[model samples]
Target chain A: MSITVAVDAMGGDVGLDVTIPASIRFLQDHPEHRLILVGDLPAIEARLSALSADARARIELVHATQVVGMDEPPQLALKNKKDSSMRVAINQVKEGRAQACVSAGNTGALMATARFVLKTLPGIDRPAIAKLMPTVKGTSCVLDLGANVDCTPEQLLQFGIMGAELVGSLTRRERPTVGLLNIGSEDIKGNETVKQAGELLRGSALNFYGNIEGDDIYRGTVDVVVCDGFTGNVALKTSEGLAHMVSVFLREEFTRTWWTRLCALAALPVLRHFKARVDTRRYNGASLLGLRGIVVKSHGGTDALGFRFALEQACEEVGSNVIGHIADQVALQLEKIQRPAVEPSTTPETL
Target chain B: MSITVAVDAMGGDVGLDVTIPASIRFLQDHPEHRLILVGDLPAIEARLSALSADARARIELVHATQVVGMDEPPQLALKNKKDSSMRVAINQVKEGRAQACVSAGNTGALMATARFVLKTLPGIDRPAIAKLMPTVKGTSCVLDLGANVDCTPEQLLQFGIMGAELVGSLTRRERPTVGLLNIGSEDIKGNETVKQAGELLRGSALNFYGNIEGDDIYRGTVDVVVCDGFTGNVALKTSEGLAHMVSVFLREEFTRTWWTRLCALAALPVLRHFKARVDTRRYNGASLLGLRGIVVKSHGGTDALGFRFALEQACEEVGSNVIGHIADQVALQLEKIQRPAVEPSTTPETL
Candidate 1:
C-alpha cells in the first residue's frame, strides 16, 4: 500500500536545511511511500537538484508563498497566512491528497490551522497533543501536553480514549492500560476534576488502571497517561529542565580536570550506550490526536535525524489507521453509555 | 542566642533507628541548641543511654503514649490520637517551649496537627509547603507543594508573599525575585486563576519577575517560584522520578559487561563528583510556611544524615525568624491593599 505524506518544508527553525534532507532520506528508505513538499518552489528545487530521477519522481512540490513566523499567534496565522506551508500541508490531508501531514512549524499555528481545515473526529470535543515518552520498560503515550489550559471530566475521558486507541493501534496492544494523572495513586486524592475523571474512567469500557502520580510517566506503569493540559505541560517541561541540568552538570564534572577528562574518554563507549537508550531524538514526534486526519508535530529545533524519526512516526500512525481506530473506539464508548454523539463543529477552540 | 527544636522521635519509616541518632548528632553539632524529644519514654531513654552527660544535658524527653501511623488519615490522627508524638511535638511549639518542630512522619498529618496547634499567622489564609530546589545558580524556593489542592487567586498571592519572604530571610537577600509558575511566560497565557494571580503578584510589593515556565524552576530564573499545590507537587515528584530514572539507566550501562565495568572503575571519581553535586539528601527538608511556628517535614524514608539536614533546616528557620518575617510581610501587603485583616479563626481548614 502506497502512503503519501504532506511535508511543511519551509517550517521549523532551520526551514529547508532540515526538512528537505529529512524528507529525501525518508523517501529513499521507504520506496512504497511518497511526499508532497509544501514550501517556496524555487528554493525547494535548489535543494533537490542533486537527487536522482527515480528519487525525484517520488516527490511532489506544492508552492506556498507565505511562511508562518516561529512566534506567530495561532489566530493571526490561521486568518492571514492561508498560503503558509504549514496550512498548505494540512490542506493536503484535508483534501484527501495525503494520508497524513507532518510539520515542525509553530505548534500553535499548526494546531489552529489543522483544526480549522481538517476539523475533529466525531464525538471528540477537543483535539489533544499526544507525545511518546521514553519509559524504563519501553514507551508510554501521554496526552494534552499543552493544548487546553482547563478541561472538563468528560474532556479528560475523551483524551483517555484517544490516547488508548493511539497506543493500542501503534503498539498492537489489545487493550492499553490508561491511568488518570493525579497527585496521588489513591482514589480519594487530587482536585474535583481528577477524582470525577477517575470515576468516569473506571466506569468506561477502557482498561482503566486507577490513578498514577507524576513519577509513573517514566516508570512504564501504564501505556496511556491522561491529564489536563496545565498539569501535563508543566510535568513535561519540568522533566526537560531537569534533564538539561543533569547533562550540563555531567559535562561540568567530566571536564573539571585533565585526569577527569581522561576518565571521561575511557567511559565514552558506555556513555554513548546510555545516551542512545534515552535519546530525545528517538521520541521527537507528537501526535495531534482526535483530529479528522493524522497530523504529527516535530520539534522546531530538531535536526534531520530527529525530523526523520517524526516522519517515521507519521508513517506508523498512517499504517495503523489511528484515526479510524480512535473514531470507532469513541463511537463504541458513547454507545455503551447511551450518550448521543455530537456533530463535529466547524469552529474549533484556538490554542 | 539559643534555639530549641522539638523532634518527633517515634516518627517516619525507621522511627527511633533514624531519628534518635540524627537528634544526637544534631545536638552535638549545635552546642548552643537544645532538643525536646517527644515519644515513648522507655524507648527514648534506652536510645539515650550511650550519650555523653554533656549531650544528654541539652536534651529533654517528653512521654507520648501514641504513635501516628505513616499512612494514617490526617483527620483521624487529629481527632483520635491526642497524645501522639507528632501532636506532642507541635504542642511544645504551641506552649513556647520550642522555637520550631521537626518531624519525619506522614506529611498530611504533620500539616494538619501543626496548623491546628500553632494556628496560622495574622492575614494569612492558609499555610503552604515550601522546599528549596537546587538550581543552576544556587537554590530556588518553590511553594504550595501539595498543601492545598484548590487555591484561589488571593491564596496564590499569599503563597508568593510567603515564599518570597522565606527565600529572602533564609538566603539573607534583601529582595528575592518571585516568579509565578505558569504554562507560558506570556501574560496572556495560563488559566483564569494563574492569570489573576499574575496580576495580583505584579501589583504587590514582591520582586515579581513576571511569569515563568516549569523549565525556569531549574534554570534559576528567580529566587522563589510560586504556584498552587497541585502543579507544584506534580513538578516536584516528576523531577524526582526523572532523576531516579537517569541514575538507574547510568548504573545499568556501567554494569552491562566486563569492559564497561572496567571503564566504570576508571570513572568512579568523576561519577562520585556528579552524584555529590545532585545529592537529594542535601535538600531534604520542606517547610510548612504561614503557620505561627516553624515546622520542617523530612522525608520519611531518609537515613540519619538526611534527617539531620532536616534538623539543620529547622535551626536555620528558627535562627532567621522565618515565621516572624512572613507574618510581617503578609501584614504589610494586606495594609497596602486596604483590606481588613481577619482575626485568627479557631477552626482552620483541614488537609
Candidate 2:
C-alpha cells in the first residue's frame, strides 16, 4: 500500500507560500507517496489554483478548521481546539490514514497532541522531544527538549536508551556511545539526580560512555546525550544564540573595510556552503519519541525548504523503524532496572 | 593603606610561566598594590628574577610546597594538601596579609581552600563560583558555576542575591535584572525544582524578570541568571563549546579560497578586535562569592595574558568590595526567606 504524510498547512510564519509548493514537489518526485494537507481548504486551494497544471493535479486537501496560535499553551489548545491543525495532522496519523505527521506549530501543542493520539509506548513514563542539533562530529540528538522538565533517573536511563537507538538508526553508527551531560567530565561531578542516573546508566544495557561535560555536548563526542528537558532546552537555545552571535560577528568583521567586502563577494560560494553545514534548518524537526506513530515538530520559523526537510525526516523515521528498536532497547533495559543492583553516580563533567 | 593581592604561583597547567609573570605585571601596573606570591618560593622567585627591574622590586614570594593536582578530589586534597598553593593563597587573605587571593589551579581545590581559610558569610550555607561570560550585549555574570549541584529553591534565591550584587558592583548597573533560566519563558514550564525556585525568586527582594528561555541567556536579556549548579554548569560549558564551534566554522569557511584568505588578512585588524571582545582571556576568572576575602579561579589552560586579566579582575572585586556587597544583599534577602513566602511550586515550562 502507498503511504501518506500529513502537513500542517496553517502552521509556521511563512505559511503555504512554501508548504504547498514543497508538498507538491515531494509528491511529483515520489509516485508512491501521497499528501494530506491539514489546514484551511480554500486558502490552500486558492494558492494551489495559481500554480501550474501538474502542481494542481498532485494535491489533496483535508480541512482542519482551527489553527493553534504560536503563543497558545499546547495542552490548553489541544484540550480546547479539538480540530486545530496540530490535532488534525496527528489524528490523521493516529487513525492510520497517514504514516507520519509534520507540524511547524507550537512545540508544546504538538507534543501534547502527540501524546494523546499516538499514546506512550509500554513501560514509558513520559514522552520526550528529540532534536538533531548540528555538532562538530556530525549531528547529535538531545532529548526532553520541553516535554518533561523534571526527569527522573529512570527517565534519563530510558532517554539514553531511546537516544542511542535514534542516533544509531539515523546515523550510520552501530551501538553508538551515550553520554550524560554534566557540569564536569568526572564521574563524581554532578548532583544527586545525575549521580543516581550515572549509576543506573553504568549498569544499563546500552553503550554508556560515562559522563560528558556541557562543552562535550556539541563536540560530537557521543552518539547519544541525555538530560532533563530543562538542561536539554537550555543547551539547544544557547547553541542557537552562539550560532547567531557568530554569524553577527562574521558579518561585522566581513564589512569592516571595502577590501573585505570585495573578498566576501569572491568567497560567497564557500561561505554559503559553510552556512549550510551549520544550518539549523537542515536539522529540521524534533521527533516525539515513545509514541506509536511518527510525529516530527518542525522548527516554528521554518521555511518551505525546511518543511520539505521535515517531511523527509519524518519518512525516514517511519522507514527506519526506530520506534521498534527503542521498544526493544527499553524492553531489554526494563529487566536491568528491576534488578536489585546499585550503581555510583557520575556525570559528563566529572567523568 | 597598602592593599595585598595573593597570587597562587604553583597553580594551572602553565603554573609559574603565567601566574608569576602576570602577578609581576599587575604589581608593576599598580605600584600602590602589595604582592605576596604563594607557592614554592625558589621557583616563583626564579620566575620573578627573570622579570624586568621594576616588577622585581614590587614583587615578593611566600613558600607553599604543595600543589593540588587537577584530577584529585577536592575533599581529599582539602584534607591532605594543607600547604597547597590554593590553601596558602587563601590563608594569606584570611590572616589579613592580603585583601584577595588569585589562583589558576583546580577550581574545586581553590573553592574548597577559600571556604576552609576564609569561611562563608554569616548565615550563608555555601559559596558559589560566579563567571562573567561573553554575550551579545557586551557580557553577563552567571553564578554557582560548579559549586553546588541540585540546588534547592532557597539556594537559588541566595545565588540570585549574591550574583545580582556581584553584577551590580562590577557592571555598575543600578539593579541588574535576575532571570531564572528554564526550558520555557513562562511562569510554569519546568520541573518541581525550577517551579519552586521561581516562587522563591518572586517572593525574594531581588529584581527578578520572571522566567527566561535558554535562547535569551546569550542575548544579554538578563544580568544575573540563577539556576542550580548542575544546570548552570551545563549552560556555561554548552555556551563555551558553541563559541568554539563558531570560531572553527569561520576559520574553515575563510580557508575556502585565496581571495577569502586575502579578505581574512585585510579583515585581520577588525577580526582581532572582535576576537578580543569575546575572547575567554578577558573574562578568564570565576569569583568565589560568600567567602570573607576575595578569591578568583582562572581557567587551567590560561596563559600569561589570561592570568594578568584574572589578577586585574580580582583587584577590581577587592577594590569594589564585591563580597561585602553580597553580604549586605544576603542580609536583606534573608528576611524574605523566613516568611511562608509565595510557594515556589510552579516550574518554568508551565509559565
Candidate 3:
C-alpha cells in the first residue's frame, strides 16, 4: 500500500520555497510514497511546475484559501481558520485521504488543530509532541515538547508508556529504556509529581531506568525521556540556544586572523563532520505522538532539507504504524496494571 | 572591615587537594579577606603547610569531626552530622563568625543544613540556589537550581525579586531586567505556576521583561531568569552536559588527523580564548540566595582553579552584602504587593 502524506505547503516561515521543493524531493526519493500539497493553488502550482515531470506526477495539490500566520494564537487559528493549509492538511488524515500529515506551521496551531481533527488514540488522554535529538551515544526521543504544559503523575506514566512504544517500534527493540527526566537520579529527588511518576514507572512493566537528570537526555542514558511539557520544551530550547552559541563562538574564533582562517581551511572536513553530527536540521521533525492519526511537525524556520526530513518522518511513522503500536501498548498496559481508575487526565489545572 | 568566609575544606570530590590551595590563592590575592577552613584538622593542616607564611596568616582552621559523603542523603547529613565541615561552615554564618560560607559538598545536604542553620531571610519563604552562566551577551543568573523543586506562583514571584536584587547587586545595576522562564513568550504559555508568576512579576515593581524561553538563558536576553527549582536544575545541568559534549567533540575533531593536529596548534590561542569564555570553572560558585546570610556552593568536582573562583564569588557576595539587599527588596516588594495573606507555602503537593 502506498503511504500518502499531506504537506502544509503554505506553513512555516519559508512557505512554498522550502515545503514545495521538499515534497518534490521526498517524492523523487520514495517512489512508493504519494504527497498531497495543501496551500495556495497558484503559488504551489508555480513551484510544482519547476519539478521534474515524474516528481510532479507523484504529487497532488489541494488548494487552501487561508494561511495561518505563524504568530496567531492556537485558539484563534482553531476557531476561525478551518480552511487553513495547516488545518486542511491535518483534515486529510481525519478524512483518511492521507495516511499522515506534516506541518511546519505554528507549533501551537499544529498541535491544537491535529488534536481537534484526529482526536486522541484510545487510552491516551492527550497527544504529546516528541522530537528526536542528537546525543553523545545516538539519538533519543523527548516527549510533551509543548502539548500539555501541566501533567499529572498518571499522565506522565502514560507518556512513559507511549514513549517506550514509540522507541521500541522505531529501534525494533522489545523493551526500550525509559527514564523520567528529573532533577537528580536519586529516588528522593524531583518534585512531588515527578517522584510520584517515578514510583508509578518503577512499578510498571516498562524497562524503567529509575530517574535520569537533564544531562542524561544528551548522554543517551535512555532511549526515551519523559517530562511535563513545560520542562521538555525548556530543555529543548535551552539546548538549541547553547548549540547555536557554541557554533557562533567557534566561528568567531576560527576567523579571527589570517593564520586561524588557514587552520579553518585545513580542518574543513573535520569541522563539516562535527557540524553534520550536531546539525539541528537532521533533528527537525517532531512526532505528534498519541494522536489517532500520524502527524509530524517540522521546525517553522527550517529550510527545504529540513522539510524533506519531516516528510520522511511522516512516511516512516505511517509505514511503522506507530499510532497503532502506542494505542495497543497503552491499552494493554492499562488493562494489566488494573489501574482503571488512573485515566490520563487532560486537565492542566489539576497539575 | 576585613570580610571573613567559612570554607568547607573537607567537602567535594577532591577534598583538601583542591580546597587548601584554592584558599591560599584567594587569601594571597585579597589581603583584606580572612578564611576559616572547617574540616578534619590534620588533613587540612598538611595541605596548608605547602602555602607560604604570608598566605597562612590570613587563614584559620576550625576542626570538624564529621565529614559528609558526596552521595549521602541530605536528611541524614542534617540529622546526624552536626560537626560535618558543611554544617560547621554554615553554622559560622549563623554565629556571626563569618560574613559568608562556601561549600562544595553534597548540594542537597548543603541546602538542608544551610536552611536549618542560617534560616530564610525575612519575607523570603525559601532560599534559592542561583548561579551565573556564560551567554552570548556576557552572563546571566538563573535561580532555584534545586532548592524548592515545586513552587507556588507567589514563591516564583519572590524568586524573581530576589534574583533581580542579586543581579542588581553583582552588576551594580540599579534595576536589572528579570525574565520568567517559560515555554514561550506568549501569555498563554507554560504551566499554571509560570503563567501566574508572569502576571505577578508584571504587576510588581521589578524590571520584568515578560516570558523568556529556555534559549533566552544563553541569549543574554535578561539579567536574571527565574524558574521553579525543578526546571532550573534541569536547564542548568543540560547546559553543562551540552557544553562538556561540545568540548569533547571539538577535541575529537582537532585530533582526528595529523593535518588537523597542526591546525589545532595554529588555533591554540583561539581555542584557549573560547575555553576561557565558556569555562565551567568561571561559573562554579552558586549563590544560596534568600538566606539570612550569604553562602556559596562550589561544584563538587571542581579543581583548584574552580575552587578559587568559588572563593572569589563568596568574597564578592560578602563585599556587596547581597543577602541584605535581597532581604530588604523582598520585604519592600511584599509591602508593595500588599499580599500579606500570601505566605510562601513550602509544600510540594500544593504545586
Candidate 4:
C-alpha cells in the first residue's frame, strides 16, 4: 500500500514556506507516497498554487482552525487547540487517513497531541520521543527525549524494549544492543530508579549491554540508549550546545590571523566534509515512539532539507512497520519475563 | 599563610608517574605553596628522589600504607583502606594539616571519604562536585557533577547557592549569575523538582539568571549552571563524548586522501590552536563543594600536565577560600529566605 504522511503545514518557525516546499521536494523523490497537508487552508493553498499541477495531484489538504503557539502550555494547547494543525495531523494517522504524521512544532504540544489523538500501544504506560544522535561510527537512537520526565522503572524498561525494536527495524539488526544511560558504567551506579530498571532490562529478552556513561551516546557504544525524559533531554541538548560551541571556536580560530585564514582556505574542503558529518540538520527528525500510530517531530528551526529528512524518517517507519514490530516484541518479552514473582506492576490486561 | 595541598600520590591510572612530576611542576611555579604527598612510603620517596632540590624543599611526604583501587566501592574503600592515599590526603585537609586535597582516584571513594571525614558545612545537606566546563565565551561552572544522583529541590537550591559562591570566589565576581539547568528555559518547563528549585532560587539572594537548557552550558549563558548530579554528570560526559567523536571524525577525514592529508598539514597550527582553546586538560579539577574542607577530584586518566592543572585549581580554591565563602553565603541566604513557612525540610540539626 502507498504510504500517506500527514504534514503539519502550519507548524514550525517558517510554517508553510518550509512545509509546502519540503512536501513538494519529498514527493519528487517519493513518487509512490502521498502527503496530506494539515494547516490553515488559505495559507497552504497560497503555497500550493505556486506548485506545478502534477505536484498538487499527489497532495491533499485538511484545514485546521487553530495553530499551537511555540511557547503555549502543552495542557492548554491540548484543551483549547483541538483543531490545531499538529492535532489534526496526528488525527489523520489515528483515523487511518495517513500511515504516519510529521510536525515541526512545539515538542511538548506535539507529544501531548500525538499521545492524546493516537493513544499508547498495548502494554505501554507512556510514549517516548526517540531521537537519532550522530556518533563516530554512524548514529545511535536515544529514547525518552522529554516525553515523561519522571518515569517509573517499568516505564524505562518499556523504553529500552521499544527503543531496541525501533533501532532493530531501522538498522535491520536482528536485535540492537540496548544500553541504560547512567553516570557510571558500573551496575552500582545511578539512582534507585536506574538501578532497578537495569535489573528489569537484564532479565528481559533484549540485547542488554549494561550501564553506559554519557560519553557512550556519541561513542556509538550501543545501538540504543534509554533513560528517563529528563536525563535524555539534558544529554541531547548538552551535545548540541557543545557542538555549536566547537563550531564557533573553530570559526574564530580559523579567522584569527592572515596565516590562519590561509590555512582555512586550504582546509575548506575537509572542514565542509567534517561539517556534513556532524551537522544537526542531518539528524533532525525525532520519532515519538510507543503510540498506536507513527508521529515524527522535526526541529522547528530546521530548513526544508531537514523537514524532508523528517518526512523520509516517517516513510521509513511506515514501511518497516515499527509500531507493529515493537508491539509484538513488547508482548513477547513481557509474557516470558513477567512470569516470575517479580513481575512488573503493569497488569496483563494492559497488554 | 602557606597553602598546603595534600596530594593522593597513589591514586589514578598511572599513580606516582603523574602525581610526583605534577607536584614538582606545580611547586616550581608556586613558590609560596607546599604539597604533602600521601601514599605508600617507599614508592612516593622513589618518585620524590628524582625531583629537584628546590621542589623537594617545598614538598613533604606522609606515609600511607594502602591505596584505593580505581574500581573499589566507595564504602569498601573507606572502611578497609583507612590509610589509603585518597583517604589520608582527605584526612590531612580535615585535621588542618593541609588547606586543600587533590586526588585522581575513584570519584565515589573520594566523595564518600571527604564527606565522612570533612563533613558538610551548616545548611549544606550534601556535598556536590562542581566541574569547570569549556564554553564559547570561556568556561561555566556546573554542579553537582555526580555526588548526589537523586537530589531534592532543597538540595538543588543549595547547589545553586554553593555553586554561586564557588564561582564567585574563583571568578572574583561579587555576584556570579546562576542558571538552573532544565529541558527548556521557560518558567513552565522541567519537572516538579526543577520547578521548585527555580522558585527557591528566585526568592533567594543569588544572582539568578533563570532557567537554561543544555546548549546554554556551552553558550556560556551563565557563570554557574546548577542541576541534580545525574543531569550534570550526563551533560558533562555527553559533551566530552561529542568532542572526542568530532576529533576522531576530523582525523579520519583529514587522512582520507593525499590532498586531505596535505590540507591537514597546512591546517595543523590552526587545529592545534583550536585544541588549546577547548582542551579538557585545562579544565581538569572538579571541586567537591559544600564540605567543611576543600577537595578537588582530578580525572583518573589525566597525565602530568593535566594533573598540574588540577593542582593549580586546588591552589586557586585555597587562595580564594571557596569553602568558607560558600558557608558564609549559604548561611546568609538561608537566614534571609527561611523566614517564610516554605522553609526547606532540612532542619538546622541536619545543616
lDDT of 1 by residue, A1-351 (tens): 889999999999999999999999998999889999999999999999989788899999999999999988899999999999999999999999999999999988999999999999899888999998988888899999999899999889999999998898678887999999898888999999999889889989999999998888888899999999999999999898898888888889999999999999999999999888888999999999989999999999999999999999999999999999899989999676545334454567693
Q: How would you encode candidate 3's per-residue C-alpha lDDT over B109-143 as one tens digit per residue?
A: 99999999988888888889998888888888898
Lowest summed-lDDT stretch of 10 residues in model 4 chain B?
Answer: B342-351
Chain B fold agreement for model 1, TM-score: 0.95
Query: In model 1, which runs have C-alpha deviations exceeding 4 angstroms?
Result: A339-351, B339-351
Q: TM per model?
A: 0.96, 0.93, 0.95, 0.96
In candidate 1, clashing pairs total 0
Native-referenced DockQ of model 4? 0.85
Instruction: State which docking tier applies to candidate 3.
Output: medium
Q: Please list the residue runs of candidate 3 whose C-alpha ends up more than 4 Å from where it truly belongs after superposition.
A: A339-351, B339-351
Least well predicted 10-residue stretch by lDDT in candidate 1 chain A: A337-346
Q: Name model 4 segments beyond 4 Å from true.
A: A341-351, B342-351
Give lDDT tens digits, candidate 1, residues B1-351.
Answer: 899999999999999999999999998998999999999999999999999999899999999999999999899999999999999999999999999999999999999999999999998888999999998888999999999998998899999889988887678877999999998888988999999999889989999999999999998899999999999999998898889889999999999999999999999999999999899889999999999999999999999999999999998999888888888989999777544335554566792
- Per-residue lDDT tens digits for candidate 4, residues A1-351, read 589999999899988889989999998887788999998898888877767677789899999999999988999999999999999999999999999999999989998888888899988999999988888878789999988889988999999999987887677777889999999988988999999999999999889999999999999999999999989988888887888888999999999999999999999999999999887888989999989999999999999999999999999899999999999988988777777756645568658
**Given the true complex, what DockQ would model 2 score?**
0.53
lDDT of 3 by residue, A1-351 (tens): 699999999999989899988888888889888999998998888777667777788788898999999999999999999999999999999999999999999999999999899998877788888987778887788987878888988789899988887777666667889999998888888878889999888988889998998898888899999999999999999998898888888898889889778867777787898898788888889998888999999999999999998888887788788888888888988777656455665568657
- Candidates 2 and 3: which is better by DockQ? 3
**CAPRI tier of model 4:** high
Backbone clashes under 3 angstroms, per model: 0, 33, 0, 0
User: Which residue runs of candidate 2 sit more than 4 Å off their true CA positions?
Assistant: A50-58, A257-260, A339-351, B52-54, B257-260, B337-351
Better of 1 and 2 by DockQ: 1
Candidate 2 per-residue lDDT over residues B233-342, each given as its tens digit? 88889988877776787787777679777756755666676787778888898888888889988899989889988888888888788888888888877866774445
- Candidate 4 per-residue lDDT over residues B122-169, each given as its tens digit: 998999999878888877899999889988988998999888877877
lDDT for predicted candidate 1 compared with the true structure: 0.92
Worst 10 residues of 2 chain A by lDDT: A339-348
Candidate number with greatest DockQ: 4
